[model samples]
Structure formats: C-alpha cells, structure tokens
Target: MTLLTKLKKSNINRSEYLFLENKLAFLTTEVVENKYRNSKLVIGLLGFVSIGLVLVVLWMQRKRKGLPIVGLSRQERNIQGLILQGKSNKEIANELFISISTVKTHITNIYSKLHVSGREELLQKLQN
Candidate 1:
C-alpha cells in the first residue's frame, strides 16, 4: 500500500481525512495545472458533434428541395447553361434539336418559375 493509503487506513480524525482528500484533489488538479487536458477533450468532442449536427440539418434541408428553386429544372438548367455561353435561343434550339417555339416556351416557363421579368434578370440571378 502507498504511504497515503496507509495514513488513510490509520484511525485519523475524520476532519483530517477530509482535509487530506481536499489536498489530493487540489494537488492533482489546480496545483499541477493539468486538469484542462480533460476539459479540452470535452470541448473538442462537443465542437465535432455541433459541426456534424449542422451538416445533417443542411443535408436534410437540401433533400427536402430537390432543386433550390422551381425554375432550376434539368431542362432549364441546361438551357440556361447554353444561354450563359452566349448561345442565342435559336442556336440552343438547333443544338438541342428542339423547335424554336419549344425553346421560347421553355424560356417563358423558366422566367415564370424564376420569377424573372426577362433575360437580364436571368443573368443577374445566375451571377449571384
């Protein structure tokens, strides 16, 4: 047994034993200045959990909306991509083998879904 263990086993007064317990705690914690190691681990764990929770929330939100906006459908996204490349609607229609009227209809739908007034607004929305 250790010396401290032996002292504890002795019939010392209860008050002295209590004082010794306090001294040991202080020595191993406050005096040594190493108690923060456990606290740091706890803080790091909490940070990781917080980040994970935030990512999960973001993922669920994204899943709830297949696309961020109603206008950003597959066809609209493709058409917009071509438009941003400076392709005219007719050229886009020819490239996609869609009719000119089909292209115009898609354009109108895209504008309505995007809540845009015209091509300028579409460009602005894409820029941001």
Candidate 2:
C-alpha cells in the first residue's frame, strides 16, 4: 500500500526504482546530519551563556561587598591585612614562613596597586 510498493507493482523501470531508493537514503542521511549539527550548536551556546552568567553574578557580589583593593593577589591581600594589624615585615615573614624579602616584595606590589607610597597611606586609603 506504500508509494514504493505501488511503484514496484507498476511499469517502473529497474534503474528508476534504484535511483529513487538511493535519493531517499541520501535525504534521510542529510536530515540526521543536520539535526546532529544543530544539537551540538545549541549545547555549545548554552555552555557559553552559563559561564557568562556565573561571571556576572560573581562581579555583582564583589561590587556589593565594596572591596577597597581590586587587583591585589591573594598573598598581597594577606600582607595588607597583616599590615593593617600593625605587623612588621619580619613578623609577617615569620608567621607566614616566607623570606623577609618576599614579604617586602608583596608589600611593594600591594602599595603599587593601591597607589599608596607606604603603609600609612595604604591604611588611610582603606579606612576611607
């Protein structure tokens, strides 16, 4: 009762039937390939959008907290906090188990990032 069955029962030539069968196979393959490609594209887009949303939420949270220093490294922030608590370079180095020179270097970087020349100015900047 199908079209192919009716065609086979009719006076269709052998070559014509073969051609129609091959064309149908090719169209089916093309449709499956298109669907596969579209699914991959949709999945990739969703991943990209999810990452963007997470980054936006993190930025908003940081902004809401009113952070004073924006670009300080973790180590630098730790040094800044120690400095705020009136810890000297040698004491900070002893507590953190780092060399005094390394502690000094982190302090220098912190000062540069905060645009403060020394600890006093850094404290003043953070307080206000």
Candidate 3:
C-alpha cells in the first residue's frame, strides 16, 4: 500500500473512515448540485434581460404616428412649409435660392418621406 493509505489505515478506524468518506461524498454532491442550479439561474436571468433590452430598443425605434414632420430635415421642413403656403416648385426654388431641379428633388424626397403622391395628397395628409 502507499504511505498515505498506510498512515490513514493506522490513524483511522474503519467505521470512522467510512463515516468521513460518506460525509465528504455528500458534501461534494451538494456543492455540485448547488453550482449547477446557480449557473442555470444566472443564465436564465441573462436571457430574460437580453430579450427585455431587445424589446425596449424595438419599441423605441417604431415610427411616430399622427405627425410625419419629425422625419424631415430642416431644408425639407422649409420646403414643406412653402408647399403648404400654396407656392409652386419654381417659386420655392427662387425663394430658397436653389435650382428648380433641386427644389423638385427636395419635393420628391418629401413626397417619399410623407408617403404622398402629389401636392394635394400631401396637404390632405398633413391636415389629418
């Protein structure tokens, strides 16, 4: 036998050795089970937090209802204001010191952003 086992055999009685061994085994099993349970709880909590954060971000990103003006840039907002005042594209171009094509492009971008096909539709949508 090894020196350690020979020492244990000399120092410890059979009943005492068996009781110590059983206690150690029980304690080790309890530790393993507790660790497993703790790790699972931590993982489950992290999963819920991750999903909750994703849901909050998605909720915040949703498009605002009733007022589409928030989506327009300053220049686009200016163009929209002029359009509301019954100005023609040429008039808007001259007033804004931009080319007529630039005005048309702005108007097109505004139309797309506002989801309108024409000036009348734009006015009607903005009214509601």
Candidate RMSDs in Å, in order, are 8.3, 8.3, 4.5
The positional error of residue 104 in candidate 1, measured at the CA in angstroms, is 0.5
Q: List the global CA lDDT of all models.
A: 0.81, 0.89, 0.87
Best by TM-score: 3
Cα-based lDDT at residue 8, candidate 3: 62
lDDT of 3 by residue, 46-91 (tens): 9999999999887766644334656788999999999999999999
lDDT of 2 at 55: 100
Clashing pairs in 3: none
Model 3: residues with Cα > 4 Å off, grouped in runs? 1-10, 63-74, 94-97, 111-125
TM-score of 1: 0.45
Which segments of model 2 are wrong by more than 4 Å? 1-6, 67-127
- Put down candidate 1 lDDT per residue, 76-125, tens digits, no spaces: 78887887888998999999999989888888888777667788877887
Candidate with the larger lDDT of 1 and 3: 3
Query: Please, what is the TM-score per model?
Result: 0.45, 0.47, 0.68
lDDT of 3: 0.87
Model 1 segments beyond 4 Å from truth? 1-71
TM-score (C-alpha) between model 3 and the true structure = 0.68
**Two-way TM-score contest, 1 vs 2, winner:** 2
